[model samples]
Target: MHIDLIRTSSKSLPHQISETLSQRISSGLLQQGVRLPSVRSLATALRVSQVTVSKAYDVLEKRGLIYCRQGKGCFVADPEHTRRQEDGRWQDVYDDYLPRAQLWRNFDYSEVKYPFHIAAIHSELLPLKNIGDSFASLVTQQPELMATYGNFQGDLELRGIMRDHLKTRGIALASSDVMITSGTQQGIDLVARTFVGPGDTVYLEAPSYTGAIDVFAGRGAEMIFVPTDSEGMRVDILTRMCDQRPPKLIYTIPTFQNPSGVTMSIAKRQRLLELARSYRCLIVEDDPFSDLYFHAPPPPTIKSMDSEGHVVYMKSFSKVIAPGCRIACVAAGGNILSRLIAAKSASDLGSPLLTQRAVLPFIAGKYETYAAQLRVTLRGRMEKAAKLLKLYAPPGVKYILPEGGLNLWLELPASPDIGKLHELAEQESISFLPGDVCYSAETPSRHIRLCYSQMNETDMEEGLRLFLRLLGRFLQMGS
Candidate 1:
């Protein structure tokens, strides 16, 4: 390697050198399997100490941008990876967002301390060891389950256990009524495919799950937003919408909804069911966080109150259990179940039987116990986070005390553009989901969602403190 060919400023030698070298390898100027010079030799050529070159190479190797063999010199690593690495420049890979909007789809997580990761309503308090043991047992006893495709309806054992479990939630159904999915998101997609089509009207909560909104729009459904408050989706507005062009489907997260942790009242659930049946519309109820309640016992799902079989209920073990397990269930009513099954069969034969077996222990009786434990733990964490926010929330922000679930929705006092907040947070290594991103409509933006699930009491406090600090600074700068 030529010494003068590589150049960097001594002011920040290691970082500059690393970036320069990363650019070369990533841009293919340095081809894969091309050996890097010896650390001392490169240092001498660049007029830097051996330690600086060594440190740069160390960072490159750790990032998988380059690799070092035992005796062979370090060489450029895979550059064609679809996903970028920790040291990657996301803007180089994906198109950039506008002035102040958050281009979150391009977020790189490795280097971020907290990076305001408030988009996913997931919890880190998952049952790993117990579930892992169950998986091992399945592999040992029912090894054939892995080799064969799962039944279209899912593992019969899991479905049976789930049927009994649903009884406690007041949703009465049999194994035949249920189908396993990759997650609630896929369940929502399958339901969308089953009932909706191009130009079909679909009713959505004003700020619903972004993924669901994307799925519905991707299917070419014309979305109409029904306003939502603390009580959940406005039934009166929905009733009016039904009178007009009745929506083909209504998507809602009734219990402990994402972004806003509002659980619908029983009266609203009944009204929604009535509206669905009256209009002959399908109600796709996502209740993944119903089990993570910290307030009063959660109300019965819309499916339970359905008399006309208009509701399609979906839940996931991903939030409560391990996310990677990819175990989810959906209970369909009317002819929707059959259509969903057909769509699901086309989407993928079925969810894995091994995943089903791994979650059986939870479905049988263990998940309930584990869930109870998690609720208590989460309640404590939520309290801590609330206290921190209440104490340290910067002067132009407002937030509600969530009833249950992993996220906190905040309304910025001055309505700063999301692009500004995203940029500031990105600089601070913090990431968050601005509420506007969740909306499918054009409205004045002033909201953000904070996830408190992954962080402990300390991280929650620190995260909230950092968030308030950043927002306060933004308000001052008026950027």
Candidate 2:
């Protein structure tokens, strides 16, 4: 078989040749078990040196795209054997994981540019020097940590630091009550795995964090979405739902909710905690954005008010600090914390020690000072984004100026089709999370979530302009 090599490009000839052959194998043009041209023959055919052809073959072999045999030419690797499951038999074994897998598959937009779907803090705002210095100190002063596994409950010093941190927020918990997780996502998964199962009911805010929704749904928990107003999840509605059928877990983002960006009122927070206690249901309070408030600090967390062990509070540092560290703490009483710790141990042995060590000093030392400054920067961005939205949003579109958090939820007019709008936005290189994915159940939604914190000031404004232009065009077409 003749293999084409591009020698004109700036890339090394061997690299170009290997990439071409790899593509052929991946595309199935080079069938499994088919022997490729010999190194000498291909070198002569392409008028290149044998060393170059051999180097290309070596590249392909190392990548597992091809395998070399003694006294034989290289052959394409069998795609079936490389796949996780050769046939469909493994489907029965991992049937439970497919729903969440499919959810993630559908949510992927990695290829999109200027994406507003992500809720992460912009990288530019992170304290790079502080994190780098902490990491460097850990490596230089305590190199032994590199070879050892950390405590399954997490580093003792970090837990102590997190305990002190929680006290300032009104949640009193001992160091033992706090368990370290990879992040809020893992904390949610651990709780879901330990407490929920098929046919168990899990209540969540109507438009909640998609990650939480996926985790609970994957565990086969029956999801019941509680509607939200400007004040966050309606505790009254939740109370009625609990009376009808007590849920196993009430998963909520009470402070600066994921898509809605609404903080629960203090009265509602108290009522929700009381309802959870009376119903004997556990509340998984995901509080990632509470520290990001623009005005005065939001109300006391429900976990703070829980004298009974009814609330599992997960506080993520990824929002304010570097996400690369993947450090977060879960605070729950002994009974639940034990189960969560067990689940965490079963998941990954423990989170990386180096990362925990790297983040500990930052959390203990400069975190409060950094967060105070970050809040101001994020508030400014939020205000600027809101002003742009107000000026450029399509006529009749409605949105509430969020008091805090990185996202703004937009409610489109009845005329413009959401699916069409998404398509048009993509054509303009703009992207945002469609509201339907945030819901536990599929339904028509005239809403979208725009995350203002993922992009810089310039990109944020430009993207919003593109998005509004498309939205206006779609509205006009529908009119």
Candidate achieving the largest lDDT: 2
Q: Top TM-score: which candidate number? A: 2
Q: Which regions in candidate 1 have their CA more than 4 angstroms from the true location?
A: 1-110, 118-124
Q: What TM-score, to 2 decimals, does candidate 1 have?
A: 0.77
lDDT per residue as tens, model 1, 1-479: 43222132122567646755664453344656566677877788678899999898998888677887777667777555233344654333242111111232424455767745643333456678888899889899989978989888788888888778887888898789888889887898788777787668889887888778767755656677888988999999888877776778989999888878888999999988888877777889998888888867888888888767788888887667888888888997657788888898999998887888888876687788888888888788789888878777878678788788888888887657676688788788777876765765445458888778765566667877887887777887873
Which parts of model 2 have CA positions greater than 4 angstroms off? Answer: 1-96, 101-107
Residues 36-67, model 2: lDDT tens digits: 78888778877889999899899888867788
User: Cα miss at 261, model 1 (Å)?
Assistant: 0.8
In order, the Cα lDDT scores of the candidates are: 0.75, 0.81
Alpha-carbon deviation at 197 in model 2, angstroms: 0.8
